[model samples]
Structures are given as C-alpha cells and as structure tokens.
Target: MLNRALRLPTRAFVQVRSPRGAFDATLGNLSAAGARLVGIPERTIIVGDWIGIHCVGQNYSAEVRWHFDDTCGLMFEEPLSEYQIMTILGSRVAL
Candidate 1:
C-alpha cells in the first residue's frame, strides 16, 4: 500500500498498545501518515480506535484508520517530530 506523498515503503516490528488492554503486533509497511500491521488481535481495533506504538525506545499515540486480518492502518494523533520518525526508521532499517 501507499501513503501520503511518496515515502519509501519500509517494514518494522512495532508494539501496539491499547488503553482498553494490551496489544502487541508488528507493522510491516510504514510511512509518515499511516502503516500496515500484522498479528492484529481477534478483537480487532477498528477505525478511530485509539492506540499507542512502541518503537525505537519511543512511544506514540495514534488512531486506527482502517484494518483487515493481520493488517491495520494508523494515523498518528500527534505527528512525530523529524527526530522521532528518524529514530523509528533507523531502528527498523537496521534490523
């Protein structure tokens, strides 16, 4: 899938957490606006579902924009600073 603009598609293992409970999943493709993930819970988070992401020693909160089995899209509620995005991308690329 593609995201806003034209960021190179990158894959990463991300830890997704929910306020209602705990969710651990991997993000396969990511960009500045949204991402596609895998291993989403059976009680799948739907559009607008609030969530938190743990990556590269940083935490970010976002909302679920769309989802399918083992794949979900997220839009960061609070845009990450350039430093933060770089940190996440660097760690994932390094892996």
Candidate 2:
C-alpha cells in the first residue's frame, strides 16, 4: 500500500492555524489523502503537529507530516472525495 497517488497542482491562497499562529500559504498541490502547501514564509511548523487549514470557505484538519524550506506536507484527517477535490480546485480557477 505504498503507491504514490496523483496530485493536482493548485495556487489558491489559504490560512493555516497552528500552535505557533495563523499564517498564509499557497495550496501547491492536492490529492485525496494529502496536500503540498508552499510559501509558508515562516518555518515554525513542525512534523506531528495538527493544523487547521482554511481554504476557499472550507476548513480541513490536517497533520503536518513533513516540513522544510518553508514548505510542508499535510495529511488530511479524513481523506477528501474526488468531487470535493474538483470542487475546491474549480472554485479558485480564474475565468
């Protein structure tokens, strides 16, 4: 059970609330199980920390699985469905 899942790159602005504080980030890419968050600006987030991610009017509870170079990977507490993923990506697409 170790196949690398597909990821769709995105560039939506979002807010992340962690133990350190809330800050902005880019939704770099996404999949059903997790996502890549870029442009953290600050490197305060650490692995094993649970963070709340707010994007496009939706809130997601995710764990900071890895972090480095002002970027982090988040594993969603509950995997998102395909419909939800497409909806999220579509909402931010410029016309």
Candidate 3:
C-alpha cells in the first residue's frame, strides 16, 4: 500500500518505549507524518498509544498507527527539522 499522503520518503531508526519496555528498530521508510519501521518481532505496542521515539539523534513523541510482525507504522506528533530528517535518512541508508 502506497501512503501517497506523505511527500518525502526517508529511512530512519525508530525507538519505541511503552509500559512494557524499550526497543529499537530500523524504520526503512519515513515521511513527515509517519514511518514504516522494520525489524520489530514483538507485538507489544497498541495502536494510538503514545510512545517515545528516537530517530537521527532527535527524540520525539509518536503514536502507533499500525503494526504487523516485524513491521509497524508510527505517526509522529511533532514536525522534525529538515536536517534531522535528512540525517536520519542518510544514516539508515548507509547501514
């Protein structure tokens, strides 16, 4: 499914922390609104639940929009700076 609503597609790592615990995974695709995070094998997050996420060294609040085994989409609560976004994308691409 193509989320055409997002203009820019980037890649970054997403850090998710909930009541359960904390985990980090690569978000292979990103946008200003949300991101498609990969490498997550756990299903402890719930949709619409607020979470703390770190990407490109910048931390932000986000909510779980959707998820599946090893993959998920998180909607950011705040807008990220262009530099931050680019840095995240670059770092992920390099890996």
Candidate 4:
C-alpha cells in the first residue's frame, strides 16, 4: 500500500545540485516526503545520489530515489510540514 500523502501539482522552477554540478529543473509535484522534478538531463543523476534543491527561497537536502528520461524523484532528508509547503507555494505565487 502507498503510505505517502497526496502530492500537490506545481510548476515552480527549482535549482538542483548534484555531484556533477547544478542545473535548473521544474517542480512537477510535491509532498511532505518528496517531490518529482522534470527537465533534468538523463544519466546525470542516479538513485541514492545526494542532492541539494532550492525553491521559493528554501533549501532542502534530498536523495534521488528514481529516474526516467528527463524526470526524477527525490526523497527529502527531513519531511516538510503542510504549512511549510503552503508557504513555499504561496511565495511563488506572490512573486
């Protein structure tokens, strides 16, 4: 059974940093536990790789969980609160 909370669809632009370097990606969906990203170059990252993600003035430590083509899934080191997720989304809208 899936145990994760429902993910909220979003189109926020985020910066991603991997061992290779930093790149820009689009946030597809987000939840307290993880996020799905698109526009990442294929083969640039692998499962279990540690990465840093920046979005809406917030920084997060995450681990790559899976990837397919240009999209990848990330699991956050520390889960975000519902309030925090809303705050980030709100900031993006306000900008």
| lDDT, each prediction | 0.73, 0.87, 0.71, 0.86
Winner by lDDT:
2
Note the residue pairs that clash in candidate 3.
none
Per-residue lDDT tens digits for candidate 2, residues 1-95, read 78898999888778899988889888889999999989886655889999998876789999999998988999999999988798778766644
TM-score winner: 2
Q: How does candidate 3 score on lDDT?
A: 0.71
Clashes of each: 0, 0, 0, 0
Deviation (Å) of 81 in candidate 4: 1.3
TM-score, one value per model: 0.77, 0.89, 0.76, 0.88
Distance from true position, residue 50, model 3, in Å? 1.2
Question: Quick one: how many clashes does candidate 4 have?
Answer: 0
lDDT of 3 by residue, 24-48 (tens): 8777676777677777656567677
- Pairs of colliding residues, candidate 4: none
How many angstroms is residue 8 displaced in model 4 relative to the true structure, after the best TM-score fit?
0.4
Model 2 spans > 4 angstroms off: none
Writing each residue's lDDT as its tens digit, candidate 4 over 32-76 gives 999998999866798899999987778899999998889989999
Each model's Cα RMSD: 3.2, 1.9, 3.1, 1.7
Q: Which stretches of candidate 1 lie over 4 Å from their true place?
A: 1-3, 93-95
Error of 1 at 40 (Å): 1.1
> Relative to the unseen true structure, what is the C-alpha lDDT of residue 53 in candidate 3, on a scale of 0 to 100?
73
Deviation in Å, model 3, residue 76 alpha carbon = 0.4
